[model samples]
Target: MTKLWQQRLQRQQRLMLRYLRLVFNEFFMIAVFILLGGAAYSYAGYIKTLTAPLWWSRPLVLILLLVLLTVGHFATLLQAADSLFLLPQESALKGYLKQAFSHSVPLPWVLLSFVCGFLVPFLEIGGGRSLISIGVLWLSVLILKLGQLWGQVVQLYLPTTQFRSQQVTFYGLSLLSLGLGLYSWPALGFVFSILTASISRWRLQQVQQQHLFQWQLALNQEASRMLQIYRFFNLFTDVPQLQGQIKRRRYLQPLLRWTTGRTTNPFLYLNWRGFLRGTEYSGLYLRLLVIGAIVLLFLQQVWLALVIALVFSYLIGFQLLPFYRSYWDYPQQRLYPQPASRRQQAFLKFLTPLFVGIWLVFSLAAYQLWLAPFGWVIILGVGVFNVAFLKLYVPNWLKRHEN
Candidate 1:
């Protein structure tokens, strides 16, 4: 079982490395650096402004900790065939699960600590804690997270109702533990966390003894988990593992009428309809647009807001570029009367208005950030960017990946 798990883990890591290289390519890394630098600067400036604790500071901190508690899930790495092929070895699979649990902890622990470290300012300003006390609080939360992960693994063996009931109890204990840590004594929280983790360990042993392995449930969970990962990668590039869902979106149907005229290209109709009905392109566009708008609304610096807006607009455009060839798998599409060049023209026609709408929405959100002449300059810059991206970058891209 250990060797089997090692083989699976190595394969998964290789697959992940391939996708990670694609997802974190040059442009994305640069964007991440700029975004992180800007965010850190803004965070520091905001922290300086909080001279005193606000009324909601404690509650907000508690809520953040509560949310953080639920950040990690179990990874079983079990396959569909495992249910049949490994049934004879099921008794020994406990060791495999133990190894899986061990493998999962490091990531969540690092993430928990990283986020908790950022909350130090809030702890000091809001609750007036010393360094030592804050250290204790971090340890307490880390232990609670371990307990949570243990509970997750243990629940895999139990019935649904029992699992849910255990979850509620665990949540209640975590809430009380964190609340006490933040509000009362950090040491008290630490004590409660140790007890919680120990209890979960005990429950895990009980389940392993009493219950049978729930192979189908575990396989479904792993599938769902991998799907989530593939969905994120789908935003950057094509992920064969990820399948997009199509929706009717009846209200959006009226917007497609513009594609009906005799002068319209047939490809335009397909593009518009596909984008409106499918979750892939449409959902990605809306999520980026909404996130960009929110970021622009909050950002006080005009230049920073403009940079962020342009970055998001570029991302939306770049991601949607892949959708241009979305119909290539359909043999019928190849028989269309339109010339090859006309297809490119049709794509440009579809993209032009979309970029314009994005520009308009972003400009409106950043209106407050605009200074007299700089606003016009920013607008022109975005316009020029759209032109360069569509005319220069896109054609080069198509040449490189000629369908």
Candidate 2:
């Protein structure tokens, strides 16, 4: 019986991987995301520049980014199988997640901390204490990752969900506590991280000791759904009519109203309209805002403050590319006697960088109190690309294959 279930689980694992491989292929272009991501983090001068605006900004952004570092370990991989939910045997599902996390959580922190550790040394070159803090920061990242993984297993099989809710607060506090290590005493933060990690392991043991639930399957289906959506959108060359299925969020009607209704091109209008209304783009917006808030939170210098804004400019442009591509059916775009496909491509010319600029201006202003020497460089980059670059290239590229 155990052998049979194990075989079933193995097959399920392969299926999940296939789904994942397909999704990754769609996002191959977006692999460049790491470059922009590193650009913001690699520059501590930027973090310091943004921090001087508010005393709280540094700790808050740093803490939030730390938590992101921790959570990301789990986010990186897909679960092997979810059909365990529909299976006959319960025990296999119960402890499965524990094994998975044990296998997965350490990698993200190790990689991220290594990157962070190197960056910190360069950023805080003169301060020995700050260097020690960076070292502790690297150690604490692994501890936090382990602790959070343990806490999540505890959340799964426990009798009540309330305990899971408490676990979140615990994780938040751990990050908040860890941030202090970056300041006064690096050693103390390291100790606290160890202690918290111990508590998470303890919680997991308590669940095991009590035999509270049967097993842990690949239950985080939401993550799988997100990957699936990204995959499906990759299918159609034009905005697959079905793309609307992903964009329509009735809850966002109030927010959708904020997008200007004046554009004659409905696709252009809807692309902007949908971008604002959907939870997907809100997250992107939220992340930009969060980055700005962090830089402002830790605003200690002039030159570094606007880096968040600059990177966000790139992010906004990259994410909006799909929307720009979908603007073909915009009515104003069809005013001339052009093919429907041609009209759509033309509308994309204007829409692509418009969204990017909106986010860039808002993100940059938070740190704009000083004239960061890099500010004009960013503006010039944005203008040149938005005007001469994207407009010139996208239209021609679309024309090459216009059927």
Candidate 3:
């Protein structure tokens, strides 16, 4: 059983390494370092300017810790076939699960510790918490995280219908532990966390004694984790293994119809419909737009907002280029009487309004930041440049790649 678990762990590591390499290219790594540096600098500046912490500081810190404790789910690396093939080794599987728990919990602990440490300066400066109290808070969070992990394992024994209710109960307990610790009751909070952990372990033992391994549930959970990783990686590179999900989104259908109706070109209509129905392209566009909007709204720096807006515009155009290329996949599309240039025109037409909408969002944010006509002019100028760049460059680039 130990040997089998080691083999599975190694396989998972190799798969993760393969994807991580694709994601952490040279340019991306450099950008990440720069972004981190900028964020740390900005955070320091913000912290220094703080005058005795805001009234909501303690509750916000407590809530963030609660969220961190409760939000993480476990990854056991167990496969669907394990239940069937290893049913005879059910007793030995406990040892494997023990190994899995040890392997899984440490990374989250480290990350959670880093976050707690990051908030320390803020809490000390703003929330008026002492070093001892903050230290106690950190330890309390660590204990609650352990309990949460064990609780997740206990959940595997539960029916799907009861899983969410169990999570809510566990989260409530975690919040209670946090609340007690924040209120200068560290001893009680620590005891409560230990109790939660003990109960979770006891429940797992009870389930193991009465039930067989839940292979399907473990497999589903593992698949969901892998899919999330793949989806994030897909944003940077083409992930052929990535499966697309679709939703009917019936309410949005009218908007699609109206947009497509404005264009008589068959390719334009197809482009609009494909974007509205296809998951990857449409989802990427919206995610980037939302991220850009969030950056503009919060960053308070005109140059930074413009940089983010332009970068997102480029990404949106680049990702959507495949929407046009997807048409060539079908023989019927090739047989259409529309000219080749019409496809380029259709792409530009579809992209223009989308970019314009993004421009408006950024411009509004710029207005908030600068409150000047010059800021508006600068935003409009950048928006025009992005649209012109997309219109002139993307179609040619796609054609070149196609040829």
Q: Which candidate has the top score in lDDT?
A: 1
Top-down TM-score ranking: 1, 3, 2
lDDT-superior candidate, 2 or 3 = 3
Clashes of each: 0, 21, 1
User: Candidate 2: deviation at residue 265, Å?
Assistant: 7.6
Model 1, runs deviating above 4 Å: 333-337, 371-377
Question: Model 1, range 37-151, lDDT digits (tens) per residue?
Answer: 7777888898888887677877888899889888877888899999999999989999999999998898889998998888898778866777777888899989998899899
Per-residue lDDT tens digits of candidate 3, residues 314-391? 666666666777786667766766667787788778887777876776667556766743456548666786767776
Worst 10 residues of 3 by lDDT: 26-35
Task: For each candidate, give its TM-score against the true structure.
Answer: 0.93, 0.55, 0.85
TM-score of 2: 0.55
Minimum summed lDDT over a 10-residue window in model 2 is located at 234-243
Report model 1's TM-score to 2 decimal places.
Answer: 0.93
Off by over 4 Å in 2: 1-70, 73-86, 115-141, 161-199, 209-381
Question: lDDT score of model 3?
Answer: 0.74
Q: Give the per-residue Cα lDDT of candidate 1 at 197.
A: 89
